[model samples]
Target chain A: MTTDAAVELAGVTKRFGDVVALDRVDLRVPSGVIFGFLGPNGAGKTTTIRLLTGLARPTSGEVRVLGREVTSAGFEVSSRVGYLPDVPAFYEWMTGEEYLAFVASLFGLESSVAKKRAGVLLEAAGLAGVRTRIGGYSRGMKQRLGIAQALMNAPALLVLDEPTSALDPIGRKEVLDMIEALAGKATVFFSTHILSDAERVCDEVAILDRGRVVANASVDEIRSRAGRKVALEVAGDVERVERAVAAAAWCRGVTRVGARIEAAVSDPGSAQRDVPAIVAAAGAGLVRFETVEPTLEDVFVELVERAS
Target chain B: MRGFRPFFLKELREIARTWRIWVLPSIVVVFALTGPVLAKVMPEILRSMSSEQLGGAVISLPEPTWKDAYAQWVKNLTQIVTFALVIMLGGTVASEVRSGTAIMVLTKPVSRPAFVLAKAAANAVLVTATTLLGAAATWAVTLAVFGEAPLRPIVQPTAAWLAWALFLVAVMTLASVLVQSPSGAAGVGIGVYAAISIASLSRWAVEHTPAGLIGAPGALLAGDRPPLSWPLAATALIAAAALAGAAVLFARKEL
Candidate 1:
């Protein structure tokens, strides 16, 4: 394990019989950062969460969480970490307070201390003054309570599995706020299929696709790595303009979809300077010309495409 | 052993709040109050009902005694209470796993062994508590109905039956941990119970295994002497082994 890492997975391969869920996956999340694990559905996001939390063992490789091997894992790491599985289920008979109190007890908290923490967390999760049992809670309410219970111990590391995958826009924003507020307080590692949610809160992210880590870097680094796309719409000879733009030394790749030509540039500065001139020489009216900053979604799609 | 205290307390609370609170204890308490009364009046009720059915012919029946009251209580426990225990506890572990509740608890600082042991301990305590209450009720009703109720006779068979009941609890615990569906676990539990009951026909099996205690209760209530120490020890040993097996299996199991 790295000295500063809160989680490290080295060449981890997890297979269920013949089907590989995670293929030689490696990830290192630093301490005190909200690390986003971004992937599409069935992209080994949940499988990695299981391995990192000691809920499942990898087929072959080392998994270290908080400097302890999670395969031989025990309360040593568990005591310091709090985890919320996706769509977390609770004792339907327990109220939000009661569930948090029960979670507090699992951490060996004193009764008085547990009660105090439960009260505070319930308030923060917007569950205060609601004493109804969990069975009657809405999906959004249960999700909030799930986050509250995971925070009962004030753990050093918080792991949430697709915390916002099932929530509405408002609920997702609230959860992202709760997670973002934990910055510098704990190492927050949350997996999500929502790219915007990752871009909104995470300082670093690893994008997984078909059991492989396609990209892992800070949001800005990954965006810059994908570089920039200069997309332009011409009023005439769109295919001819796409060919001319593709043949330019400055344009790495160009695609024509209808009238717009979106080109991947080796250097955004040169492409931004030369795109207009190239379109003018081709005798095309430049209806729209703009340098598009590559989004995390763009990077994800590009990487997953390349990896495939 | 870590986290057993809180988890056991939570289990007890769940038992009190869920359908579990109504199922097993309702059967035990209702039977305790009614079984002995039925035992005392069964002859008269049969005589009246069978007179017309018998076409005016008379039938003979043994006079009822305090032993009959013990027999009544034991009968209800063996037939209804044992089956109820299997069905009630069958989902104790599996339902948690199916509902994803076990993931919430097990992912914490709680060890998997502690989770299994806590559930077993809670069920044991619940069984012991209700059995003791039902026994006291049986004794009181027997005294009121038949006047010569010696406490020793009631105590003896109740203890013997309770040992068997606790063993069933252990078996159901193993079944609950082994099967993922509540109904399937109950089926497995009942199948084991049926197998053991069928094995009780052999004198050697009855004298040496938990199946022995099934009939030992009747013998003790009837003042017939039968060897009990072997079955008692055997049931305890096997119950312990089942519990240990449950804990070990639960530890290795995936969520």
Candidate 2:
């Protein structure tokens, strides 16, 4: 594990009964980076979170958090990692303050410090006024409380499993804001199927498919690899333009329907180079021309599909 | 100790919120309060039955004493209250894992052994309190009915009973640690109990062996055959060892 990396998994494998949940997976998340774990359901996102947080042991391979081996130094690593499960549950009998206080004490916080921290965290998570029983909390409020508890120790790494999956749009935005705010100070390894949520907050991402990480790179790197897609709506001879686009050197594939033409291009740079020539050669009158950037969603679907 | 304090408090709170605390105590208290009254009144009711309704039943009845009431209380406890407790808290440890609440705790700096120990301590305290309440209630009623007819002889038996209760709870903790669900834990616990009982039934020297620790309430307060000091001692040691085993298992188990 590098000193700069908050979490590192080297060829980790985990199995549940007959199912291989995670297989030879490797991930390295730098300290103070918002790392997105993007995968569809059952793509081993939660399994990775459990392994990183020391909630579950890997069937084989090594896991390190905060530069310490997980199984052997779990206590040391866990003391520095705060985790929120996909569905966080608190002792229903407790109030928000009480629950956070209990979590703080588990981290060996002094009573005065724990209370002060809990108060500040509850406020930060937008749960300040919700002093009632946790059982009475709405799903969103519970999620907010989950965030509050996860950040209780101000851990070096914060692992949130599908933090925004079950939330409404507003709730999702709130969690994203909390995650974004933690950047530059704490390493955030957030797992989610919500690509928009990842795009909204993550600095780096790993797209997992079928118990393996298919793509691990920064948001920019993934977008760069996916390339850009250009959609052009032309007024004339769509079939002629399609034939012309098929022979264009800069384009990968082109499809047309009635007046609309969409092309997967080699590069956005080349789109400017080759699009006009193709349009002029076919003599098509273009109504609209637009360039679309690849999003985290596209990258996720592509990786999952390619892996399968 | 910090984690144990908070976790134990949390466990107690769970017992309070759920039906576990009220269900068994209600049954035991009801049985305790009604035992003397039922014993006192049952004979008269039997005598009042018409000959045809009685179907040629004998008319004369034995006087209802505190001994009879105590007997009734013990019978009800052995049959119902203890069983309710076992069924209710059977999955205390398993529920946390199944519900993923254990994730919240294990991710903290607290040790897994502390987690298991806290749960065991909380369950032990709660069970002991309720059982003692039932015992005291029974004793009070029996005293009022039978004029305190030398109840000291029962104290040793009651102590032995408490020991077995501790043993039962230790086994439940072991079951809870081993299984992932409450129903699974209860099944394992009951199976452990049955295996022990069947073993105890054998007339071999092993029957009287400390392995008799497996038969809890039955082995505790059976007869003038006093609680075996060696067996009781052995069971306590084994129960402690089992609890330690559970702690070790939970420490290594994936949440």
Candidate 3:
């Protein structure tokens, strides 16, 4: 908290014609962490990235990255930042190594050092042995090369838009590992519709819905905000069991299946203490009783659905 | 112009590695070789055709000269090479934007002005090199075919045409920025060219505007000196203005 923030947006509102893409969205990401910007398609995640990268201007608000206002930075601030769009494109005639070298030249990297750095990055990206032109590459290979191209500068802040959106399971895992390896070296802000990928690597996440930010906090804190859910299974009189808990002070809502009942509880401690006894009094043997924690996906769906 | 050198080099490499290298240079080479040969054979062709159509009627026609050969070369370069040049350079910025390649470069420390000016400079080199190559070929062949041809006469007209071609490069650069598609940008370029040709029909327009440069090449090669200062200065000013306008507007576009 003492260090300066990596990115900050205050009351950012972007509109394309009459459609509002992002509406008064405000967020702050601290430096030296992996932050996730999670949303479904059409949730304005890319719009936010465009503003931060100076590819776009907001209808009304301030967008700052690494402590400099975006529009003012123009070219100078980009030296310390790297970005990968959702669909990264390249010159079809260029070989993988040639493209990286071109990117390095833009950053003013020396020839000798640039080649070595490019080799190391290509190796890390799993494209070291490939010598074909970029036009001949598959989608996955292109994505790997894209990651390599973005790292040519060793930027202080890396912004990625859906880095794993097109990868297979194994490829996604390797990319996630690469992102996990970059936790302290740079501030990695990545957006994804896949909640599990964000859940796996992010220290904090913000869920956006319908052009609005519904939740922004650490993973555990957001999970806690979904409250606690309890499921109980009994031998007999499941309807009586549901009736007993539905009227309790701690229970928020209850749903009964054929022989089991699930309920949301405001106080997990009170529910754990009282639910078993209440079920026994309703003449049903308590076969199972447990409190379940919501996964990040469950939390995301709950938050987004509630906002909608 | 923070990243001008590297960006410009990349553009040159792109031109060499793609189909762009083949189109303009090949067009000029073909025209340069054939223009003189066609000029030499035209009188005989007309005599042969008229003998059959006019039933052996006598005819008097002047002998073709190196001037005819040189004029044919200039006409082809101006009418045909200019269109090819337009189609070739029209997508300089638009294709990059559509293909998302601009995003890759613009995200670096490269300035917008540098991105646009790099394309302009690199394509200008291509246009200049090919035009000069064609002119040299025509000069050598015209001398060989006609037994006598002056180098100064050939050089003057080619220089004027080169000025107009380079100005078209700047026009296409701005067109690519204003229009998002390659063909659409080329359409804008051709429309401007047609407009200028039509406006040049006026005597005053030919004497004062860039339309003057369009016909200046033929007149200069025939050993007639026009008031060229106005057209040359106009070409330079307009080209510079188009480039500066492209840079300023591209900087504000929401990619």
The candidate that wins on DockQ is 1
Question: Which digits, one per residue and each the tens of the lDDT, describe model 3 over residues B1-255?
Answer: 999999999989988999988999999998998889889999888888788888898566789999889999889978999899898877999999999999989989999999999999999999999999998999889988999888888899999999999999999999999999999999999999999999899888888788999989888987888778988898899999999999999988989
Order the candidate numbers by lDDT, best to worst. 3, 1, 2
- Single out the weakest 10-residue window by summed lDDT for candidate 1 chain A: A66-75
Looking at model 1 chain B, report the run of 10 residues with the lowest lDDT sum: B49-58
State how far residue A22 of model 1 sits from its true place (Å).
2.0
- Candidate 1's displacement at residue A100, Å, is 1.2
Can you write out model 3's per-residue Cα lDDT over A164-240, one digit (the tens) per residue?
Answer: 99899988998898899898999999999999999999999999997899998998898888868899999988888
Residue by residue across B1-255, what tens digits does model 2's lDDT show? 337777777778777887767776788788977887788788878887845586877688778876677667666765565567667667778988877788789888778888888888888887778777877887887777777744554454455556767777888888899888898888886676667666767654234444444343333344445336677767778789989999989888877
Write down the TM-score of every candidate: 0.94, 0.92, 0.93
Give the per-residue Cα lDDT of candidate 3 at B62: 85
Residue-level lDDT of model 2, residues A12-126, one tens digit each, is 9999999999999999888889999988888999898888877788999988888888878857788788888889998887889989988887888899999999999999988
Better of 2 and 3 by TM-score: 3
Candidates sorted by DockQ, descending order?
1, 3, 2
lDDT of 1 by residue, B44-92 (tens): 9888777878787777789998878888898888888988898888886
Q: Which pairs of residues clash in candidate 3, taking residues 3 or more apart in a chain or in different chains? A: none
Off by over 4 Å in 3: A1-3, A232-250, A254-262, A273-289, B52-61
Q: What interface RMSD does candidate 3 have?
A: 0.7
Which candidate's lDDT is highest? 3
